[model samples]
Target chain A: MKNRLRVLRAEREWSQQDLADRLGVSRQSVNAIETGKYDPSLPLAFKFADVFEMPIEEIFLRD
Target chain B: MTTGHAKRRYHLRMAVAMAIYIASLFVADWLIEDRGVTGIAAVMLASVPGLCVAAIFWILARLVIEESDEFLRLLYIRQIIIATGIALTGASVWGFLELYMLVPHIDAYWWPVIWCLGTGVGGIYNKLTMGTSGNCT
Candidate 1:
């Protein structure tokens, strides 16, 4: 599962720590999400979409 | 920012618990050196520190409980299962070695057993599985 988290975060000038802080999770988690190492849960995925102000489809996609 | 039980507080408690466990272990050996298990004080000495360390994990368990996210819970559960499984397997292997090749019974020494098991769980297993398909929170 790939995600545009890194791209979105970069657009917002947010580091992995910044995104993790906003989402109340560890930076490792954010890194995992960004690198496609871990897939986010539905709720967390939605939250990420909400945080990025983009639709979930736009942020996340199957590879 | 660390969540749940504040990393600093968790580390402090863990350190205190470990310190108490080691100190109590020495005390238990000293007090029981002559009297052996018959001395009730030895039991108390050993038990106090064991409970302290158990309490530390208990607190950590509570922190784990506080997380509503299933992803986080699964991470913890996976770790615990690995830890417990490794511990049991190592203990069984030690028993086998003792019974078959060396002594007739397993030695009472626990620290070395725990250290080896801990190394397996913390180092080997962790390296093998980088957190079981963790879903990001």
Candidate 2:
């Protein structure tokens, strides 16, 4: 899955650790997800949506 | 359920189980070999270390279950799968070699020790492939 997580995080001026803290995950996890090395589960995707205050589709995109 | 809490619990439980495992191994050896224990008494004495090893496995399982982070959990799952594969393959090959008299016989207990080492190998694998070595650090 492709995501604009990096752009979204950057837009918010949040570091990976900042996003990770908001999402209750490790910075490594944020890095993995941002780099497309790992995909988030539905619950975690929901968490991303919640944290970014955007729909999951807006944060993540079909690739 | 947080990473820090889960890791702390895992480390504490693992430390206690390992301490018990070592102590039980020595005690069991002393009783069975030095004291010349026999029959059911010897069997019971010899099982303590094995039971402690089982406890260590239980502690690891609990860490997997209690971990809330999906990525960390995935890393642990990967580590366990790699460890299991290495341990089983090593034991099976060694068993065949022993059966064919191409190698010396080893105590079956060594398989679990190999499995423990394989977990370290798995962590290294994770570090190379996943950019993180899970929570064991």
Each candidate's lDDT (Cα)? 0.65, 0.89
Candidate 2 chain B: worst 10 consecutive residues by lDDT? Answer: B128-137
RMSD of each: 4.5, 1.3
- State in Å the error of residue A2, model 2: 1.2
Model 1 per-residue lDDT tens digits across residues A1-63:
877787788788999889987877776677766777568889988888778888999999978
> Which docking band does candidate 2 fall into?
high
B14-131: candidate 2 lDDT, tens digit per residue: 8888898889889888888898989999898888889888786787788889998889989988888888999999999999999999999999998988888888998999989889
Candidate 1 per-residue C-alpha lDDT over B2-82 given as tens digits, one digit per residue, 9 for 90 to 100: 454444455666677778878877777777774476556566776776687566556556546655544455565565566
In candidate 1, stretches whose alpha carbon ends up further than 4 angstroms from where it belongs are B1-4, B34-39, B66-77, B101-137
- TM-score (chain B) for candidate 1 is 0.61
Q: lDDT of candidate 2?
A: 0.89
By DockQ, who's the top model here? 2
Candidate 2 stretches with Cα past 4 Å from truth are B135-137
